[model samples]
Target: MKPLDEQQAAARSWFESLRDRICAAFEGIEREAGSDAGFAYTPWDRVDPSGEPGGGGVRGVMKGKVFEKVGVNVSTVGGTFEGEFAKSIHGAGDDPRFFATGISLVAHMANPHVPAVHMNTRFLCTTKRWFGGGADLNPPIPYDTDTADFHVTMQAACDAHDPAHYPRFKQWADDYFYIPHRQVHRGVGGIFYDHLSDDWARDFAFTRDVGEAFLRIYPALVRRRMGQAFDDADRARQLEWRGRYAEFNLVYDRGTLFGLKTGGNIDAILMSLPPLATWS
Candidate 1:
């Protein structure tokens, strides 16, 4: 790939920094629970179709008393999108060359009461450059207070940028996260936005705020519910719910598809899958 431009470099730097801070925070939670669990990082390189050196990323995963399974990954890659896949991406239909950098995370807690969560934010450049991503909460056993708090925090981030952002992106998330075959919503909705190519500084600021909001609200929610008591029945339900999450990611998640199309590391791409899950 070619050298990154100013905006691309900045976005990549911020994403790696966010990853470090988040890993530290999660390790702190483990210590609070008297477990020494910490993230294990693995780096992988990407090869484009032309056998050129595309950028790579590190995948960090942790399994502990508090977090049953969690994966945080940051990757920056550039290459020529192959065949018809290029047509679907924004600004890539004609040129087919693209660059992207982002951070993605998914956490599944040991306690059923503590919600599972997913968050991702990315910047992509083709003929056009833009930002996209969001966070959503998925609790096997739902709680109103937790749901409300999550939405409120995300809304504050959106409102800081544009008042219209929250409702619009919230609806986008609601729609995007649905499992059409199952006819059920994946989880309590958050915000999802894409193709935000208006003002570089403004969009970048908003994207960073989204990451900050996730870092702020999710760990608190984890602490709130991670100590609650759960029975075998609750564990069963959590497992069943994880089945749905798996289905959505495997069948409907655009990020998953993007990773496959772009020659991303298979293990890193599939890290979002729960450690355990059961259908029905």
Candidate 2:
């Protein structure tokens, strides 16, 4: 078990704040759609005995709602790391001083018209240095307008900090979210960057402020489309898209890869999966 650095502490606080806002926003969405939506948060024990070394975030589930088949989770899991993917991505130095912490989130929406979304942010530190986390989206459906709006919201957040950020990072999302074998992107893409070296402090401040942007943008998008109504055909397409989502995560997502490599608890890592998934 190890103690958190200043950046990790800030990231943890941001993740917690996002967790609360996410729960409330979706609850309101379900209500507005005239559907029942509720979530349960289960706190899990940290991996290390000291409790400071690691811990799981809130796990939530919502079912039989007007616009969601199952809204299974929104969470932040933080801890130190090791193993193949972590070593490959974050580097494996002999120094035990390096510590990693991050938050990951995913939501499954009911309406075929709406897209599923995910966001993650974190900070990793060694005695001498640290870096930041950026977020991205994976929508199930391909609504051009919705996709544009989603990216635009993300871009706006980045633009406020640095104009150059929106384009480069958006392109990063576009590239990062793709399923290479399938030859299709996960969604329109938001933004994904990690271990940033340039303007690290600016990136952190930007990351923290963007949390509010997420709280504002995502629910508005969901509310607009969740109850818009879709036919059986649309529902089928949604399922098909979700199948791809599952494949990408199970097959290629970096987070999933690291979790498995670290001997992380299976349930916590797979908690990102939708409860009532369908494949065709």
Q: What are the TM-scores, per candidate, against the unseen true structure?
A: 0.99, 0.85
How well is each residue in 1-280 modelled by candidate 2, as lDDT tens digits? 4456576667667667766776777777778767565776565544632245454455555554744533333333344455333346444454433445556667777777767787776665543344444555556657788877877888888888889888888888788888998999877788887776556577677877666677777778777777677888887777778778888889888777766654455665786676555766
Candidate 2 CA-lDDT value:
0.66
In candidate 2, what residue range of length 10 has the lowest lDDT sum?
A: 69-78
lDDT of each: 0.97, 0.66
lDDT (Cα, tens digit) per residue for candidate 1, span 42-132: 9999999989999999999999999999999999999999999999999999999999999999999999999999999999999999999
On a 0 to 100 scale, what is the lDDT of residue 65 in model 1? 96
Instruction: Judging by lDDT against the true structure, name the best candidate.
Output: 1
Clashing pairs in 1: none
Relative to the true structure, candidate 2 reaches a TM of 0.85
Cα error, residue 48 of model 2, in Å, equals 4.7
RMSD of each: 0.5, 3.1
- Please give me the total number of clashing residue pairs in predicted model 2: 3
